[model samples]
Target: MFENLSERLERSFKILKGQGSITELNVAETLKDVRRALLDADVNYNVAKRFTDDVKKKAIGRNVLTAVKPNELMVKIVRDELAELMGGTAAEFKIDGNPAVILMSGLQGSGKTTFSAKLANLLKSKNGKKPMMVACDVYRPAAIEQLKVLANQLGVPVYSEEGSKDPVSIAKHAINEAKNQGCDVVIVDTAGRLAIDEEMMTEIAAIKKAINPTETLFVVDSMTGQDAVNTAKEFNERLDFDGVVLTKLDGDTRGGAALSIRKVVDKPIKFVGTGEKVDALDLFHPDRMADRILGMGDIISLVERAQQQYDEEEAKKLEAKIAKNQFDFNDFLSQIQQVKRMGNLKDLVSMIPGVGKMVKDMDISDDAFKGIEAIIYSMTPEERKHPSLLDGRRRKRLAMGSGTSIQEVNRLITQFDQIRKVMKQLQGGKAAKMAKMASRLRRR
Candidate 1:
């Protein structure tokens, strides 16, 4: 997402490398490089200047710990500043309203409608709330349909009056519908409009007034860089949004918007859309994001993702199975499914410390597990349950069925045996717990 910025920041930090402490000369040169990196990342000129200046003021003459290197100390300083620059901590919103209204505002193509559905799904599945999506984008018929499709997929209700041109009226009726349906959360997906369009802005402003949303979020495209920041400012000046929702952060974005929007609009980034999938939404965490930008990785977020898919009872079952050497193809397939549910494979890999830099250039696809899944699926149910029953003849038949070579089938079986051995050895240790977590994030 911030690949270029991350690399540049890494290079900037290297200026302190081999130094015993943070001195004026070394810190100045490093700050210069850091400033240039921020500029190249499309950060606002004033924001970049203030950030580097603030960083310099805090960095130079700092008492470095005996065990910490100059570069490490500098990294800690910059990471803390970066976190503070982006909202010091995660912001909280009122989701407890009898029917909480969340108004979505942004320009077309910023993925606002899509994010609304994503947020609805997140609230529905994770927060135990009945979220009903209200399509108030009256100008765009397709937008309504899109929300409906996503709502249907999520099994959430959608309130829309087809062919109605009055969005404010639709919004009011939607709230009433929410009350009638006993829905606790009503996310109103408003029409996307330009910041310069006074009429459009006025329309949305009226809708916001009518609904009195508990949280009015301005959805922005992170790839738009400084433009996103400016648009956010314009919207905030008009509607005074409660927070920001950054969409398409998983794309090839320079990350200027994320770093600058909060400073410019004085609002917290509440959520971020990582991928196109409804499940790809994440609560924005500034410290974790700063860690990711500095190439240090976000192990906490990694563990959290793994934890979401980690089943205590299932893990216990597998632990018992591994202890008894009863791990089989069926267990392997189930583990693969858990990892797949964790979201993008490359994004998942990037969360591991040190692994992100190594595989930054590797084209790790979400389909990385397809071959392995196919091979397992080709196996007979009995063979999956009792993998030991797979003789040479069975392996050959399975390879043909899976459109793979016999060598691949043999290799998979060998790898599975090795994993069983490793799991057995790591049992009853902290390494085993981490191994189980990593295993849950593995693609295949």
Candidate 2:
């Protein structure tokens, strides 16, 4: 998401590379470039200046450790500053009260409704909360239906007044319904305007007052850049939102909103919507985000996602197969589906340390495993279990069935063999322990 900024920051750090030590003159040029990089990334002008100034202040006149390179030190300094700028740490959230109320507020098209459901999903599955989504977006046609669709996807109940136009009344009634239904949390999706206006603000304010939510979240579209920051500023002044939710972060190249909104509103970014999937929502961890912004990757988040997808009984069975050299196309297809569920392919790849930049320009699709999956699906059950069963004629038939060339089919088999060999080795060491741990994740 911060692709451009990562590249620019890498260049900025290079300004200090090969230098004898940290000095005023050398640090000046680096901080200047850093400030420029922040500005280019759509960071607020004052925030950019202050960030570099702070980094320069801490950096200048500091003695470089013999073990660390000047450039590496500068990178760490900037990474810390970046994290501090983005709220320093993840914010705390509350879902208290009989049916803990959460009011959703935002400008139109800020993904307020979508994030509402995402938040509910996270609470339901991750936090073990019985969340009921309330469709209070009365101004927008079918907005209630939209929330209902997402709520259904999560298997959560939805509350709405079919003919009522008063959002405040609707929201209040929903909370009462939630209590009656034994729902622990009530998420009220309030109406938003095309732009911030008096009427829109007043309506949400009245709703918030009537409901007296445990938390009020202002969702901002990260793709909007500076506009997102300005909108957040206005909302914070009026609503005093408990936290900010940055949506569309995966699609944004210049993440100005994420970088500036926390500082502008003096509110923590509690969550981030990394993709369109309801499960794409992540608890905003400032340190992990700073790691990403500096091209350091986010191994912690990557591992967490993997842990989420690893199935216990399945893992035990897969481990046994790997040991027996029985890892086949079926297992491979299963693995691919699990990986796909972790999140976007490019976003997942970007989490590997030092790999984000190399793939910055490449188009990494979510369907990266489509061809392999097609080839595997074309194989018969017996053929899939035994690779050697595929003779020259069988391979040709498989290629035709899969709509792939003979060469592609041969390539897949060859790669599969190599992967099978690697899996056998991986089952013998720390990798095996990691797999065991990951598989036992849900139980934890």
Candidate 3:
């Protein structure tokens, strides 16, 4: 996400690499480079200056222990300072009311509507809450329809009053509807203008007054750089928003808004939009983000995603099948599906330490398993259950059905067989313990 900033920060740490201990002169040199990196990332002049100053002070104050290298100590100091700058810990949304009302505020095209749907989907799936999206963007009927379509896809109800010009009324009515429907959360998607104006502020203020929302989130596009921070300040002045939502973090953002917004508006970033998908919303964590900026992969978030998608009962059943030598094409297909459920493939793979930097330039599509899934889907029920029964003739038939060649099918079968062997070794206990140890290291 902040690949450029990460590269710059890593180079800044190299100033202390050959030094045996940290001195004021060396720390100043390193902090100067770090300051430049933050500026290059579009961080505010004052914020970046204070950040590096704090980092320098921390580095100089630490004892020069024998076990820690000077460079390692400096990196630690920088990481802590960065975390503190971004808000030391994660701040969750207040969804405690009977029908918790979350009002989305931002300029047009800042992804307010999309984020509303994503938040609803997240609460429904993760928090086990029945959320109803309220479409109050009456100026654009298409926007309301978009919210409705997204809500339908998520299997969540959407409340909207067509042809209603009064957004406040629509919001109030939607909240009542949510209460009637037994919804635990109501996400109101309000209308936004191209820029901040009195009218826009007035409309939002009225909606807030009418609803007395439990949470008001100001959504800003991270790609706007310094403008995002400025807009956030303007919004907070009028709305006094509960938290910030930085959208389009998946884009080539220069890390400006993320680094400066919290400092500028004095509000914690509650959520980040990593992608356009409804499942792309992530809770903001300052420490984890600092690790990402320092080119250290966020393995904790990766494992949490895995745990969310990993079905323990299903895994135990698959282990039993592997031990019985009954793991077949169907089981392999199921495993692929489970991995896909963990979110984007490239995002997941990049969380592994060293893997992200190694393959940063490679094209890892979200559908990395398209070919494998197609091949598996082409197989009949009997073929999926009994992969050993497939001969040369059967392989050719399967290849043609899946729009692939015989060699491709053969390669998949070979990989699946190897996976099954690994599963068997894991079930035998020796390999499983080693795998667990490796996972723990990656998480660190």
Candidate 4:
């Protein structure tokens, strides 16, 4: 998402590339470029200045190690400062109450309603909490219905007083409903305006006062750039929210909001909406984010996501089948679906170390696996179970059924054979060691 900024930062670091040591002249030259990069990324001017100042104060007088290059040392200094500029660490999302009330605030079309459901899904699935959603956006037509639909998908309860315009009263009743339903978390989704207005601010403030929530989150569209930071400042002045939530972070945003919001409002970013899926939410991690911005990748987050989709029992069965050389199209398709469940394909790929920059210019679509899936779906049950049964004639028929050329079908069969061979090799030695580590992560 911060493609432009990443590129600019990379070029700026090149100014120190062959320098034998860190000097005031070289550091100043590199930081001038860094400051320009931050400004181009829409970062706040004062923040950019202070960030560069901090980096210089820590960098200029530092001794460059024999093994570490000047550029490498500079990168470490900048990465640490970037993390500090964000939030320094992950913020705790407190659900500590009889029924923890979380008041959601933001502008309309900021994906507030959608994120409400995402949060409910996360709490129910990960935190083992029964979350009840309260739709208090009575002024917006069908806002309550939208919350109901999202809550219904998660099998969570929804409290909404139809025909009631008083959001504060509705929120108060929703907490009671949550208590009766044995829900441990209550997320009240309030209405938003097209822009900052007195009536909108007053209504949400009253709702917050009535609910006395455990956590008040101000949601903002990250793609709005500087405007997102400005809106957060205004909201923080009124509600004094516990944290901020940046939505639409998966879009082509310059990432200014995420970099500047904390400095502006003095609040931790509790969460970020990565995609439109109900499970596309991620707890904000400033250090990992700083790594990604510097093109170092985020292996920890990638492993965590992989761990989420790992099933011990299923892995045992799959390992057994692979050992027996019985891995087929069905198993292949299952693997594809598991990867899909992890999140966006490109985002997942970008989490690996040093790979993000390589594929930054590639248009890796979520539908990259569509053709293979179609071809496999066209296969007969017997063909899927045993790849040996797929003769030339059968492949031609499958190609015709899947609207693909015969050559494409043949290529998939060859690729499947190669994958089986690789699995066989992974059953021993160094590969087996890696597999053991992965197993431990799954169990963790």
Candidate 5:
């Protein structure tokens, strides 16, 4: 997302490389480049200046520990400042009322409607809340249909009057409908104009006043850079939104909006849309994002995503199967499915420490596993269950069926076998450790 900024920041930090201490001269040299990087990333000029000043204040004359290099210390200081610049911590999303109302506000093409559905999905699946989407975009028929389609996919209810032109009325009625339907959260997706105007602002303001939403979020397209921040400021002045939502963060964005919007509008960023998928939504964590921007990766978030797809029973069963040397294509396919549910493949890989830099210039597609998945799907039930039965002739047949080369099929088999062997060895190691611990307990 902030690929260019990250690379520039990395290069800037190299100014302190091989330095014995954090002298003012070197610190200024490094932060000058840092400030340039932020400005190039489309950050607000004042914000960039203040950030570098704060970093300089904390960095200069600080006694560097013998174990920590000057560059590493500078990175730590910069990372902390970046986190503070981006709201310091994850903002709490308010969904406390019996039928909590959340009003979505932004210009057209800000992904407001799509993010409403994504938030509904997140609340329904994660928070155990019944979220009903309210389509208040009376001007756009397609917007209503889009909300309906998204709601249908999430199995959430939607309240919309087809012919009604009154958005405030639709929003108010939707709240009542949500109360009747026992929906705890009502997300009102309001209409947006190509540009902010008196009519659009007045309508949305009236709707907010009528519904009295518990949380009014300003959704902005991060790819728009400073324009997003400016729009956010105008909306915040009018609606006084409770938080911000940055959509299209996975795009080729300079990340100016994410870094500047909070500072300019004085609001916390509650959520970020990482990809187009409904499941690609994430709670905005400033520290984690700062880590990602600095190319340090976000392991905690990565582990949390993995834990979401982890099943205790499934893991035990898989472990038992692997321990028995019976790990098969079916198990492999199931594992792949779980990983797929974790979100974008490239994004997932970027979360691992130090892996982001290596793949920054690479085009790691979401379909990286397509060939293996296809090859496995083409296999018969018997072959999947007992992979050893797949001889050379069977592989050729499977290759033609999957539209993959025979060599591609053979490579998958080889890799699968290697993975199976490694998993078995790891399982054996765990078993040995458990046995030793048991013996120690008995002796005690």
Candidate 6:
């Protein structure tokens, strides 16, 4: 997401490469590069300057232990400074009140509606809360319908009063409806103007007054860069928002918004919209973001994501099947699907330690499994359940049906067989054999 900034920061760190110790001259050289990188990323000029200064001060003040190298210490200092710049710790959403109300405020086209749906889905799936969305964007004719469609897709209830011009009353009624439905959280999606206007401010203020939301989030487009900070300042001046929601982070945004918003508005970023999908919302974590910006992978978050998507019962059953030599195409497909469910393939892979830098220049498409899935889907049920049933004739037919070559089909079968064998060895606690293979690959 912050690919440009990441590359620049990595280059900045290289200024300390082969250096004997962290010195004032070396730190200045590196901070200059760091400042340029942040400015290029669209970070506010003042914020960027302050950030680099802080990083330099921290880097130079380090004790320079004999165990740690200068470049490593500099990287650590910059990572800490970056984390502080982006809100030192993660903030939790307030869902404490009975039928807690969360009011969403943002300019038009700021992804408020989409984020509302994503938040609902996140709460529903992650927090196990019953969330109901209230569509109060009554000005736009299609806004309410859009939110309704998203709510339906998320399988969440929507409370909206069509043709109602009064957003405050609509919000009030929606909250009451949420209470009636026993919803734990009521998210009121208010209307947004093309720009900041008094009328829009007055209406959102009234809605906030009426509903008395536990959390008032100001959603901004991260692609807006410095303009995002200005928008947040205006919104916070009026609504006094509790947190920020940075949207469209999956895009090639320079990452100016996320870095500047917290420093400008003094509000923690509560959530980030990574993609357009309803399940693409991620809780903002400063440490992981710092790691990402430094070109270091976030293994902790990766493990957490895996744990979230890992089904213990399903894993047990799959292990049993593997032990019995019954791991077929169907099982392989299921495993791939589970990994896909965790997150985008590139993102998930980049979370592995050392893999991010190794594959930073490589193109890993989200649909990396498309060909394999197509081949598997072309197989008959019996063939999927029993790979041995796929003889040469069956392989040719499957290849034709899947629009792939026979060689590709055979390659997949061979890889699947090898994977199953390795998994069986692991299950048998053959760590020495696995370590030998890993060592051999590394040597190669």
- In model 4, the Cα lDDT at residue 172 comes to 94
Best by TM-score: 4
Query: Could you tell me how far off, in angstroms, the CA of residue 298 lies in candidate 1 after the best superposition?
Result: 0.6
Local distance difference test scores for all models: 0.90, 0.89, 0.88, 0.92, 0.93, 0.87
Candidate 2: C-alpha RMSD after superposition: 1.8
Tens-place lDDT per residue, model 5, 1-444, is 999999999999999999999998999999999999999999999999999999999998899999999999999999999999999999999899979999999999999999999999999888899999998999989999999999999999999998999999999889998999999999999999999999999999999899889999999999999999999989988999999999999999999989998888899999999999999999999999999999999988887787777666677688789889999999999999999999998999999999999998798898988988999999999999998999999999999999999999999999999999888888868755754544454344
Q: What is the lDDT of candidate 2?
A: 0.89
The sequence of per-residue lDDT tens digits that candidate 2 reaches over residues 1-444 is 998888888888888889989999999999889888889889999888888889989998878889999999898888898899998878889887897898999988889899988888889877899999998888787788899899999999999887889988888888889889999999988888888899989998999899899999999888889988898889988999999988988885599888888777889999999898899999999999999999889999999888777678898888888888898888988988999989999999999999998998899998778888889999999998888898899999989998999999999999998998888888879668887667566566
lDDT digits (tens) for residues 1-444 of candidate 6: 898898898898898999988889999998999999999999989999999888876777678888888999988888888899999999977888789898999999999999999999888998899999998998897888999999989899999886778888888888788888999999999899889999999889888888889999999999988999998999999889999999999888999999988898999999998887888888999989999877788987876776676665676687678678888888899888888888777878888767787786788888888889989999999999988888899989989999899999999888988998888777746643544444454344
Could you tell me which 10 consecutive residues in candidate 5 have the lowest summed lDDT?
Answer: 435-444
Where model 5 places Cα greater than 4 Å from the true spot, the runs are 428-444
For 326-374, candidate 4 gives per-residue lDDT tens digits of 9989999999999998999999999998999998889999999998999
lDDT for 294 in candidate 6 is 79
Candidate 1 accuracy as TM-score: 0.96
Estimate the TM-score of every prediction: 0.96, 0.95, 0.96, 0.97, 0.96, 0.94
Tell me the lDDT of candidate 6: 0.87
Residues 204-233 of candidate 3 have per-residue lDDT tens digits of 999999999999999999999999999999
lDDT of 2 at 21: 97
TM-score of 3: 0.96
The residue pairs in collision within model 2 are: none
- Every candidate's CA RMSD: 3.0, 1.8, 2.5, 1.2, 3.8, 4.6
